[model samples]
Target: MDIETCLDSRIIHIKSDIELIDVKGQFISLAAPIRLTGQLRLTDDLRQILACIDNEVEKLTLQIGVDEAGRGPLLGSVNVAAAILPSAWSGLIEMQTLVNTPLSILTDSKQLSEKKRDKLYPLVQQNALGYVVAEIPAAVIDQINILQATMLGMRLCTEALLVAVAEQIANDTSSTSYNLQAQVLFDGNRCPELDYLKLSSFGISESSIDCQAWVKGDARHTSIAAASILAKVSRDQTMYHLDSLHPQYSIAKHKGYPTRVHMEAIKMYGVLPEHRRSFAPVRRVLENK
Candidate 1:
């Protein structure tokens, strides 16, 4: 069901002796629910529901979050990042405590200042079980278009991170076997197809994969916010490096956005190799040149 539908569903009050039924008709017995009052409190509720499902499979889940940056930029690569957060808990109380920490302060990368994102960059990496950042360059974006390239980048980031996590587990256990579950979340209205992903190859259960596209997920989910920070910081760092090499473009000022200064730079200094020729602003400039 969609978020609206899920929100419209009746809120259940958990009691030690009473049984609660979820939307899927699953009967769950809870001593108490993690009651955090807010519209976004549903995030905690969803985590509890997923925990219930994970209990049925008897597997520890890895929450994988994916987000992207620079998709709308007129130059440079679109960077995507995937972050993995472990969901190992003794009980619902422990799980609630783990998730309700300072991490909840994280929000969309665009909403944060550059200084804040830079500060959180290392913190996110340190907290995550594993993460991978992938980029689709402007040239490749020109070949396949921004949307397809973004999907491809996100897929690559998720695949690479999963493989890395699996490898780490195998090294720690001295065996290439595991029963990890994955709950993959994307920070947008639509996610790339996950059905074709080879769960077995990653030592995860095929049926245990719960891939969802959550709108405004960066604001609601800590994992998605962490991924957004990585992507945004990485892309911004790239732009800064590019600026150092070519100061005339003023890439560091606008970060390749189609702003008045950026457009004027393109018209005056002409298109660079990193400029997205497929974009209308750069295309118009190139056509005139």
Candidate 2:
């Protein structure tokens, strides 16, 4: 259901009182919406999406969720974050709607279409608060291993939020600083550092490391979805910017991930400074070409 939900250029909407009988059934407005499957499926409209979201948010008043994106891809970085809402959650939703984004599609990061991401990138940027993203360069990934890299990235994102919230509060930059806290909810059980570094690294700081990993975090977790959007938009923008330097390779097309376009670029141009020679495909290309 989360996978199929549209997030690119289509705003999902259902009436306040309309009872959603099924996907194909009428989206007739009613007095009170019937909640089914913990999610509502309906048309693409701002008010409708907001209502559905509000229904979800209203149920889970206080909780933090975490998720990751861009892991399978060979290029760019692994991105993740932990998020919890303040009293401003409603305002955040309203601000998301008011961001002049008609096709404001918010869903799991990879679920979004390329066109939709390009369109709503700015909106996500405009609306997100206490957002964090970590760019795990190829070198670090090679050294630490992918699993550890992923965990490290998530940890960094959480720390980033803590840092930002602390910064804002210290300087009184804005009202969002008060909401920052150490509590976190991750999507999986195993932490790379927890297994790798264990409690040894935390020392006295163990109490500050409060997070739990879940099974299908990005799908069911709102904070994870929020993190997913933050990471997705950030990495996409990075790809767009890098496209300028590697125009012939079409970095923007593959977004630094290994694709036919990227492979061909490697074969044609050899390795550039940013190319991850540590990757087998990149190494093979160098060996063969």
Candidate 3:
């Protein structure tokens, strides 16, 4: 993103079309010097120059946004994450910059296909800090219901992200009081009540920002989408493991969902230890068995 500046400290915005060439043929004022180049991608250069436009207003503001996926699904774990991105104050895009890269397709969790999620999982693993993903087993999910399970996962993510961000700042600041400020954002109608765990901050209390939960947050927030991919991949792996542990239940085929095939398997083979007894269908299957 280099800017051509022979005239130092001055910014130039070339808006009008000008023929840049060997201008011996064109009349020029002595005040204006001639400029020529063999090849110049001025437009391309301008894009980098534009990207360099960063917000200088805010200082060290971290926005920890949380979201989850697979909560409604009868299969995978309810995935959640609290992504600590350098707020708009930094002008740094979390995932959109990789438009042409392998992860260019990172977007809303629902918008992402199973295939896309699988592809982005590795990308997330490599990049995110405190990428703590908790797997909510069917037994536990059924015990607490999907909503509770999603909350549990979100709590775990919040705890982990807060710890991680604090540690990062502490290490960077050498234990100095840096006035660390954070705002929590989640893709839900309300804020996450992390009553289940004892949350602590280095010096600051958990500041709850209006989560601004969009209906399609995964598509809206790059951080949420990254969290979705992490949760989806982890849940799939858990399901695969369950398949190995209880092959007769065909956990792999249905991914622990109440599919017709899964129901038939339950009816024929009986429920496994992992089956959620609290869930009505599983309870019915057990009673019949």
Candidate 4:
């Protein structure tokens, strides 16, 4: 019997005498059975079947998730993080499974307390397949605008992550040689225009990497969650350092966010170089002065 297949988004529709297997979020239909005398062969339809299989493979392939912190802050730098987890390791790590000592918990960084995030930062760095943290300071944010600066930070971190992955493959003798073609999942709807790096020595083409944007990806994807934790902790540490220089701003307490205390502090201490002049409150203060 001749078989026909159609796919709509995540759903797959098939018509054939053979019973079709059910897949989650996919629908399949079977047509009337037809007896055949010899081995059945698929000609033109083979291409379609192969295409569907390829789609499935891509869906299951590894992904590098990117996220940012300090974008909305009135002070400090914006931190972007790109992280890729080892395919062999699941997202969850048992309390004492890793290392001899107990480690911090893993989840969306926003869900964790400051102490918890501080502990998990080192654990994430140790276990990540490859990760990069890129920061764009307030001066740069003021010059290029926050949105553009954020996109730039994400692009830089992603490129760094690719470099790290390449280096890891070169250094690990036990690692099997494989083509790199992982999708980058951006946390927000906007995806940065990332340039491809051609590793001529390794014979890797520019098309090896793919990019995708997923809204609220940090909450939905494990890799994005990992990236979030790294970015947040790094930015917080930077804010703490800044606080040492300008103790009046109390940056460590508010972490540069525009809380009531922060606003009052800004009014009393005035603007500093670390404050984002492009932000409305800072801009207003500058304009008034």
Candidate 5:
């Protein structure tokens, strides 16, 4: 039998044989003798193994992940994504494997190429239990500063997703309770204030939801990674559309980042309505002009 190494190092696929390997690299034969002995039959699929692993660890409640893209750009809106993934690690792992995109390869949007992020975008949306992508435009960023704008975007997406999830549960015929327990993870050191959600009309309680700001959570958590991909791809598409309208700015090339080409374009053509006046580079151009 030929051994095949999956893109994810955890999963090893064997060709022409029915043996299964666990994450710990322990091999279990799924052939006749094992079955006759009444030993547990395991599938070659990593999801089954992951399920077993999940059970061994603590079972978590609903997980909500929030992340943003285009926060540092001198132009365009900041896009924030709130995503709810399956609480089980197995289910999260399944999302990537289904698209043939390994978890290790697609851990964070920053580390992924544009092609890979585009490929995973739709798959993430389809798999999410609930999701919301909110944009805070440059005008708003200028009004409240970039940090506040980013926080606002995060808050908006999180609120929208929470409401959507609450509505789904309320409408479910089989569910008896309106109470929901969830863990909200934000991909940064500081999360937006959600204390107001305690008095929300959706019957969601502050005590029931735990919000945390996890530094580099995008790489550590599957739900956050999915959110990052969605936000990145959405922002990229926005830049592409803007580029089509204003080819001189090369928005698509740098996605409105303060590159030499972008700065030169701003200097020659002047600032667009989309440019953030609060940003130093764009502000300097405006001052000089």
Candidate 6:
């Protein structure tokens, strides 16, 4: 039996009883068939392993991932981020490896401690080929509503990322034309429809881009996870600053969420400009006053 494996550079062929398998400048000997629980499963197992490796290698390419933070916060701004990773990056980093570690810890920011998120924030930014973060303040959220605000933020971030990519291509001294065919992976079930008129300034057409929204994308997708970290960290910093200005609200502790302490502070001190007036809790407080 003959099995063929496809890789980025070449195709490897393995024949049954052949002593050697060469893949990507590496050679593996298949002369000794290993017995697993007294069952011989060398050929099938080896093939599966090689196929999985190929799949992973294929996924390590240029792509964009987007996610948002602070949508649920009653105060502070909503932050949306879009991250572009180079074609050489393997999308395998997770939140668990973000602390005092070299591996990129890419995962949903909520799953990571604040310290870990802070640690990974710079790493993500440094490794990213291009990245952009957009914030929609409380006043904007109140006017446009949270959902629209979030979508608008996403669009702006994406537009900025594309502009960055274009600039990088222009600056590259290499003669190779950078034809970046990126697929946008949004961390949700729905993405805001692109406004062609608004996107015209970025020179990006709707048809030229391929985008898809996935459920739990931040947890499942590496790029989305990185974007999650960027968005969360940026929003957290904003909340911390707001906390400094309004120490009574403890914005840093709850990060502007409608926590018990946050609600109590609203009742006692009234609302601040950072508080979203359209939010149920803030609106109720306004009604009572």
Candidates in order, TM-scores: namely 0.72, 0.59, 0.68, 0.69, 0.73, 0.71
* Candidate 2: segments with Cα more than 4 A from true spot: 1-64, 86-105, 118-120, 163-181, 192-209
Candidates in order have lDDT scores of 0.65, 0.49, 0.52, 0.64, 0.66, 0.65
Q: Model 3, stretches more than 4 Å misplaced?
A: 1-59, 73-77, 85-102, 195-197, 208-210
Ranking by TM-score: 5, 1, 6, 4, 3, 2
Can you list the residue pairs that collide in candidate 1?
none
Off by over 4 Å in 6: 1-61, 90-101, 170-180, 197-203
Query: lDDT: which is higher, 4 or 6?
Result: 6
Q: What's the lDDT of the predicted structure labeled candidate 6?
A: 0.65
Candidate 6 residue pairs in backbone clash: none
The alpha-carbon root-mean-square deviation between model 1 and the true structure, to one decimal in Å, is 15.8
The CA-based lDDT of model 5 is what? 0.66
For candidate 5, lDDT tens digit of each residue in 185-228? Answer: 89999988763533356767777778899898887778788889
* Per-residue alpha-carbon lDDT of candidate 1 for residues 18-75, written as tens digits (9 for 90 to 100): 1221223444432222111001112342334233231244354567788999999999
* N/CA/C clash count, model 6: 0
What is candidate 6's lDDT per residue for 1-289, written digit by digit as tens? Answer: 2334344422232222323323334554432321100011123222222122311222112377899998998997888888765434535454343444353555678889999999988887656655677666787678768997788667666655554443433333232332344578888999866555544444455565788897888887777888898889988988889888999888889998889999999999999977899999999999999
Q: 281 in model 2: Cα distance from truth in Å? A: 0.9
Tell me how many clashing residue pairs each candidate has: 0, 14, 2, 0, 0, 0
Over the full model, what C-alpha lDDT does candidate 4 score relative to the true structure? Answer: 0.64
Model 4 residue 55 CA deviation in Å: 26
Give the runs in model 1 whose Cα sits over 4 Å from its true position. Answer: 1-58, 86-104, 174-177, 194-199
> Stretches of candidate 5 above 4 Å error?
1-60, 90-105, 173-177, 195-199
Q: Could you give me the TM-score of model 6 versus the true structure?
A: 0.71
lDDT of 5 at 57: 36
Candidate 4 runs further than 4 Å off: 1-62, 90-104, 167-178, 197-206
